[model samples]
Target chain A: MLKSINVPRHDRVPSLIPDTQASMTRQEIANNNWEEALTFVALQRDRSAYAELFSYFAPRLKAFGMKMFGNEQQALEMVQDTMLNVWKKAALFDASRGCASTWIFTIARNVRFDMLRKKQSRKDDVSADDLWLNGEYPEQEADTDASQWDTQLLMEKLAPHFASLPPAQREVMERVYLQEKSHQEVSDELAIPLGTVKSRIRLALDRLREALDGARN
Target chain B: MAHAIKFHPGMSLLEQHAEGSLSADVALAVAAHIDLCPHCQQLSRDITADLACQLTQQPVKTNTTDWQHMLNDIMAQPQLSKQAAATQAQLSAQAAEPIIVNQREFVVPRALQRLAANHGKWLHLGGIATAKLPAGNDYHVSLLYISKDTEVPQHTHLGLEMTLVLAGKIVDENGEYKAGDLLINSPDDTHTPRTMADEDCLCLSVLSAPLKFKKGLTRLLNPLQQFFY
Candidate 1:
């Protein structure tokens, strides 16, 4: 017999994003073209636009790293590495290929991967970027729609849909994606079977996929 | 491209890849598979977009002074010119020459090209060849080549084994796998994989643990295990 456990309501609540702040952020995000900000930083070496991006992404990246590292100092280091890469590789950011948020998220993910490998003393000839962000693959020719990759718009539409998910499903999603825990780790932590964790994840993904497609259509 | 890919990494694996939660070596197999399977490529992009939305939504505890300090340092760094970036990409592309084994040259997936270029010398056995790639400590990553009309000894996995076909076809007891197909075998699975009589095959294999040959001569088993691991 499996025992039921109470899941913490951390970070996945719809009420956390109050409507007033959501509207304000939406207006600000609409007026500001993050893609253009990246372009300006690339072409003209614009410091203001760079600063704007830093103010927006740094805190979130710090939060992202915190789950992986569990230490504020190491999390800060991840933020530094990721932001520096964004600055140096700004010219490589192609808006047609992906949105600004997706691009930065890739950079952050790669940096964190490298950091973990380094800590493990795993000397790998294949870098994280080589695996995750290969350049030789054919350009994703289909679905070049700009709106599909818009981060802020998706976030706005996704907030309530994500919040409406059952608490059990939401807990699995947070553990797997936000906390960077593997399915096996989630299973062990929750005292559930491995198959159960995978099923919950699949079901949660199904619901989120439906919600996203509904919003898209 | 001769046959439609019949196998792929599971949905949970793809989701883990998008989350960047899977270990580097396991994620490599998924990345290479996605390079050939456009359907999965699209799925990966959608998942990534969703991940980005969720990630950026976390309410951050802002330390204004610290953020300002880091921002100043990052802003002071010089940015790469578009031309320089393009040149860098071109140079890396040029470096990834085709992989050659047993008098055959096979173009591996884009995700595998860089690491494959650095693969160790190919070691030959009866009708198979294996070249080790630099990978994480927990997994043994290599390029496995099967010559025409060859059969690997029957074995059961001690742990997970992931194989992605880069050229030609392979058949086990369960099914036939063609190029772009990803085969995942757990410890419970036991089978003998072989190549066709006239067609050779090449694969990217990531093994979490060594294979335990079940049906071969006991004396040959140790060497065979040594050969693979």
Candidate 2:
């Protein structure tokens, strides 16, 4: 009989084993040293550190891209562009504001939106083309210390919060929050009244806020 | 402010903005509003962080070949020089200076500042003056300046119309819209916008289609709608 190894939910301690050690799986290494690895790439231009980040995030980004764009080629391009941005903008990442996952996810999200907008512009002659012309604004100062936002702890809390939502509410939450679909689009897709979609999203957000606030307190 | 902005673009619109799904014009309007409103900014940050968390929880599948390719592309890209970055920042900073309209100098919203040079000659129509902004590709973009106590003719939108109050206040059947308030109107909605007697109203109006005049002598302005564009 095999005993399951239980990982601690909010451990900040670094694993004693080196990330490159043969005994450690790729996922284990990534989970253990992502922040350190990202910092190394940022400060030292370490190729190996970048390789670690690329290996872990590129695939995840590709999957996210595919989900957003529904095209394998575009998804691959999105991953490539996003990874390139990470490499270039690594120095700008402030741990105090957000975690590396949040930073990278934002880059992927923005890149996907850019691709979609470009496609839309080519197909239509709409007048609002100059709207997103400016690059992203500077990052705002963090309201609190980074330690207050333990990435692993938040992630652990979030999964259960999301899982606890009713299926109807969760569907709207996922579509709007994760899939980035508009309320009108989601309403049309589900063939439900717009008010129903809005209420479900509101309820889902309220529950998420309650759970996250509870954790904070 | 007589009335607080009773109307907002809804959470879904803000969420789309945070998710980077809104169109550039709408996004610009939203970004300008976010710059002035801290409440919306906090909401935006929360939504972004939540989305990031959701992304992390999803199962990821990718081949080794994809990772290798991504690494290659990242390696091939040249790193931006610190000096170059500093110069770029300086350029943007210089470009953000306020523009003078009539005698009043109003700081352009960062989103609109980039297109400041493209503003056309100020054209006066009754008590309302308009300047066409060359930036919007899909919508008719203009800066409408309404003098104190002036009233715009009652009109309905032929399509979607978005008005973002950049300065002062405008009142309609809905409510009073102050600086940073975004008022969106569709074909079904019709209203006459009037400026308060205390101050002149300045607004950035983006129209997907022309406005249809609904009352009185203004109905004749329908054929002259091209002038508004």
Best by lDDT: 1
Q: How does chain B score by TM in each prediction?
A: 0.93, 0.87
Enumerate residue pairs that collide in model 1: none
Those runs of model 1 whose alpha carbons end farther than 4 Å from true positions after fitting are A1-27, A30-32, A122-124, A134-217, B89-92, B216-219
Q: CA lDDT of B34 in candidate 2?
A: 68
Per-candidate DockQ values are 0.20, 0.15
TM-score of model 2's chain A, to 2 decimals?
A: 0.50
Runs with alpha carbons beyond 4 Å of true place in candidate 2: A1-33, A116-217, B1-6, B62-65, B81-95
TM-score of decoy 1: 0.76
Query: Please, what are the lDDT tens digits per residue for candidate 2 over residues A1-217?
Result: 1111112222332222223354246555444456677777767766677776776677677778878788889988888888887877676665555557767887787677667767765432222223332233455454343225454654566657888876767888778766779999987776544545655665465457556654211
Q: Write the per-residue lDDT of candidate 2 for residues B61-105, one digit (tens) a residue.
A: 535443554466456565544455345334534556665666777
Model 1 C-alpha RMSD to native: 13.5
- Please give the lDDT score at residue A215 for candidate 2: 21
